[model samples]
Target: MLTIKGKLGIEDFYRIIFKEEAILINKDVLTTVENSFNFLSQFSQNKIIYGVNTGFGPMAQYKINDSDRIQLQYNLIRSHASGTGNLIPEQYVKAAMLARLNTLSLGHSGVHISVIELMTSLINKNITPVIFEHGGVGASGDLVQLAHIALVLIGEGEVFYKGERRPTEEVFKLENLKPITITLREGLALINGTSVMTGIGLINTINTRKLLDWMICCSSAINEIVQAYDDHLSLELNQSKKHKGQQQIAKSMRHHLKDSTLTRKREHHLYNGNNEVTIFEEKVQEYYSLRCVPQILGPVLDTLNNVEKILIEEVNSANDNPIVDVEKEHVYHGGNFHGDYVSLEMDKLKLIVTKMSMLAERQLNYLLNPNLNNILPPFVNLGTLGLNFGMQGVQFTATSTTAENQMLSNPMYVHSIPNNNDNQDIVSMGTNAANITKKVIENTFEVLAIETITIVQAIEYLKVQDKISSKTKKMYDDIRNLVPPISDKDVPMYPYVNKVKNFILNFEEEIYACKELN
Candidate 1:
């Protein structure tokens, strides 16, 4: 079980959320939470506290009686639980729940200790709330999406337990779980935060790392397949430019292609007097997609590094309003719930991921088109050229998916529709940005999968499976084990495409490790 301490990070998130490690609350963290709750309870006596005695947002003008204060929280949970669209998957929802748990554990939301304990129970029990993809303007926090999470905390809404959507009450009984009772401001604190967007953004950041690692491997393998010169990925060439992303990508590519017998040295071929002919037969340089991988993907890596840093900090932040300050002895109300940090970062994330997908698509094109490589058969077809269309149909899937990513990459951070009587006049559509970025990331994985299959096909056509580096050769074997090479007949490629996509999505074991770029 992972213990909740002062700060949480991406690796902690991975172990708890993905590895099913139960969480243990720290004594000091819970003490701070209890102190904050007690202080808020005494401080709000006959005092005007937003979301406690007053209505929320535009409705904050009206005051609530002491008796109806409890009901007001319930009302907020039930009324705002109106989320439309598809349910967010279990993993991402759990991530949001963990993010919320960490923030509340910070002892600033004026939430009871039971709130943290109950959230921990729900997480450990794998009882994910039924959250939707649509709701969440990003500013004033993910109100609609988090409202559903809040509803589950009160035992009134449904939860996904044991792979089935069951009523929270039923699952609570089955697991001997008890719902958190509303006291002062549990409802307001639960939903008025950026955990939903931050959680999803954190997960997206993790997946981007994996996708980039595989992308470098694929880029290096393609170079070996084409027998391209090694100088493009050489240390001297990449380090000449000081961008960390470019140097890291080039360094990684060099590691991946180091043992490759097919990759030629430029100094050996061109620098020497071997270039006796006026017009050299061999193509002097590869296409930008092949040669400029370090430059193309370098910025992507650098941007991703920054994105990860921001997301981790956001996850560990008290991103809710009415922050309870034990030292200051005050309940400070402000816009900490604003999601601009996550929104802008997610927008930048999708943009870079789109560029990465474009690079993969171009590399796939170069391998399939014989005119580009001047070596491989049309479409890398090992079977009958005309009848058996090799990788021809799946290419459409990759291309269209990449185009959709280009469209989805448009900034959701900028598109804000003012709702709630314009009380949230300038909103950060952060949750929308996160959800769309998730789509872009998932779409890029599909493109990479198609690119992987195409690269392996190119390897087989050249009969250089044994000639490539151990890193890419193992990668080739991993893919070939899943989907065998195309034979003389044109089989359905959709199923194979999906298999490869899912493979890379969870393929974590790297063939070799490189220096940490960051």
Candidate 2:
């Protein structure tokens, strides 16, 4: 369990999404916020502020008085509720809420304690507000989509409560809650930031990192079963290249396949004690998928590290305009809300998903080809070739998924057009990028699951009873428990696919933990 007052940071976000309970420390956050509000009072004469005392974006030039400021912010939310796309998932919306709370804890947005209290109520009560996946230009903040969140906060929009879509006002009333009154900057504070995009990208990055590690392990298992030449993954070769990703991947593959009896030794040991010995040599110096994996995957890891750093800064810093610095007794209007940083990160994440899908597609091709597979029918079957369709449809799925990923990888960062009539001309499109990346990640998982099925079926067909590494054998058996051998056509595979996903997601953790115990 974790709690956030003013001390919330990146590690807390990670654990919370990983299913840890999170609590709020409002008292501590209020202390800093009180000082910020006092500073605003002292500098009251210099109160010409954007997003605080005036209309936003193109209308920033219009001066709004104290009496009308609250209405202005309220109207801003209602008008910007123009999000017209698929509604974001509940978990993602919850994550965005958490991120917004984190940014507010910095106490620079001039939001009152009541707003924080309402946010805490929603968190503790499991009131997930509805937010859509489009209409954020990532400039002037994630305004349109987050407006829906703001509307719900004021008990005016829609929400998914207890797994049912209900009016926000009804849910609040049922929970004995009051709609928060819009304050001077509270509404703007609620919606004016990069939280929506950054939160999605951060979660995507974390999950993708785990998947990358699992891919290395799974690929090594395949290498051992196929008797790939260890020369390609040799430490000497990786050291000569000196890329961290390459070295790490090579080291990991070697470690995973270290004790396999199926692998070939040095050149001199090729001959047996008896007569002529059979030798297995791969046709290519390396399959494009296998050889370039490190190069393609390394940049993705490096880019993710950069994105994590940026997200840490975004989450911990104030992003709203007209920030008050009570310690310095000053207020400054700035463009902290621009989301170019998060946009590029999301673009990179989509690229990583694209690579994963491509790798899986290639592996699927390898397992299906008679020449490449060496053993088994045209596509790893039990009986004669034409009689059984085998894993034919699974290969079709892999190809289609890879194609989808490629299309989604078109960088959203570079597609900025003027929004709000040149005021937000150079938008980051960060929110769209994050949403697309999430879709790509889902598609990549489907591709990887199919590849796992294909490879396990191919290995079973070869019937190599010789002992593989302990880890590899365990994985094979795990897959076998869910998926029976491919003996005939027209077999129902949906259940097997679901079972494979369940196994693969948890497989690495179980294997590594068991090895550590030993």
Candidate 3:
């Protein structure tokens, strides 16, 4: 079980979302929440505060009586529950809920303690709101997406309960749960934040970190199969550049290639003969794809590091507008809910991931083409030459997928369109950026899968499996365990590709079980 006390970290959020851990609110946070509620109750009913006694957005000037405030909150939730895309994955919904709950726990949203308890109970009971994927401009706090969640709190929307989709009221009755009434600014507080975008970004950051490690492992295997020179990965040479990511990658490459007979030093094949007149024959160096692994992937590592920090701070921040200060007795209205920070970071992340996919595709090309592969059979076809196309179609799929990733890599931060009656004249498409980034990550995984299977096939064709490094040997064996190597007979590639992708997804566990293999 995890305890949310208004100060949740990224890792804790990960566990709560992915591991389905039950949550408990800190008693101190509950006291602070009650204090804010009491402070708000002291205000006269005619006070014209945004989303409390007055209307929202451009209609903020319209005042409401005490009798209609409750109805106004309900109407705000129902009217804004207009999300239209496919249902968001349950994990993301759960993450959004946790983020929203964490922000409210800060005790500045002027919400009653029962509101927080109800949200926490939804998480503990595995009752996830069916949030949609569209309708968020990422400004004014993911309004549409979050309103879908807010609707469920009042038993007005659908929810997923025990793996079945049902009305929130039916689920509440089945689980002995009761919906709470929204009071004062509670409805606005629930939807007015960056939780949707922040939750998606946070989850992707964690997964991308694992994917980076796996990409390095794949690059190491490709280097050994292509007989890359190890001088470029020398610690001394990398230290001259003075980049932490480059130096770290160089070190990791050395460790990955340690005890491998296939990786050659530059001098081993430098000269054709000892005679002074002899020509310097033999391919002295590898292609940039294999030689510049650290240089190309180094910046991606740094970007991931930077993005993770921003997401951590965003998740832990009080991103709601009109923050209530109990100690100062003030209601300060501000734009803390803008998602530009996450939008820009996610856009950068997608571009970096697209470059990684491009690199993987180049390596895959090198492994399949006969001329580039240096004596490897065309398409690494082990079967009858003309009859079997061997990884030919597979490479094409990878190429096309990488192209799609490139198309999706355009920065979303710069493409904001005005909406919401121009009240939100400038918007942050943070959620759109994050959603497409998830697709890019998935596509990159498929590209890496193609590369992994192709590398294993090359090692098998060369009959040099025994010469691979111990780390590559483990990884190669793991791949083979999932799907057999390409043989003389041609077969459908989708099933095999999917199996390898799943293997890549679960590769982290294999590395954990064997510390030296990653």
lDDT for each residue of candidate 2 in 393-478, tens digit (9 for 90 to 100) = 77887798899999999999999999687887788998999999988988777777887787778677777645677667766777
RMSD of 2: 3.3
Q: Which stretches of candidate 2 lie over 4 Å from their true place?
A: 5-10, 268-284, 502-518
Q: State residue 117's C-alpha deviation in candidate 1, in Å.
A: 0.7
Q: Which regions of candidate 3 deviate over 4 angstroms?
A: 43-46, 271-281, 508-518
**Superposition error at 491 for model 1 (Å):** 1.0
Q: Among these predicted structures, which one has the highest TM-score?
A: 1
Ranking by TM-score: 1, 3, 2
* Model 1 stretches astray by more than 4 angstroms: 274-276, 511-517
| Pairs in steric clash, model 2 | none
Residue 287, candidate 1: how far off, in angstroms? 0.7
Best by lDDT: 1
Candidate 3 per-residue lDDT over residues 411-508, each given as its tens digit? 99998899879999999999898888988998998998898888888888988789989988888888899778777878899998999888776553
lDDT of prediction 1: 0.90
> Regarding lDDT, does 1 or 2 come out ahead?
1
The lDDT of model 3 is 0.85
Q: TM-score of every model?
A: 0.98, 0.92, 0.95
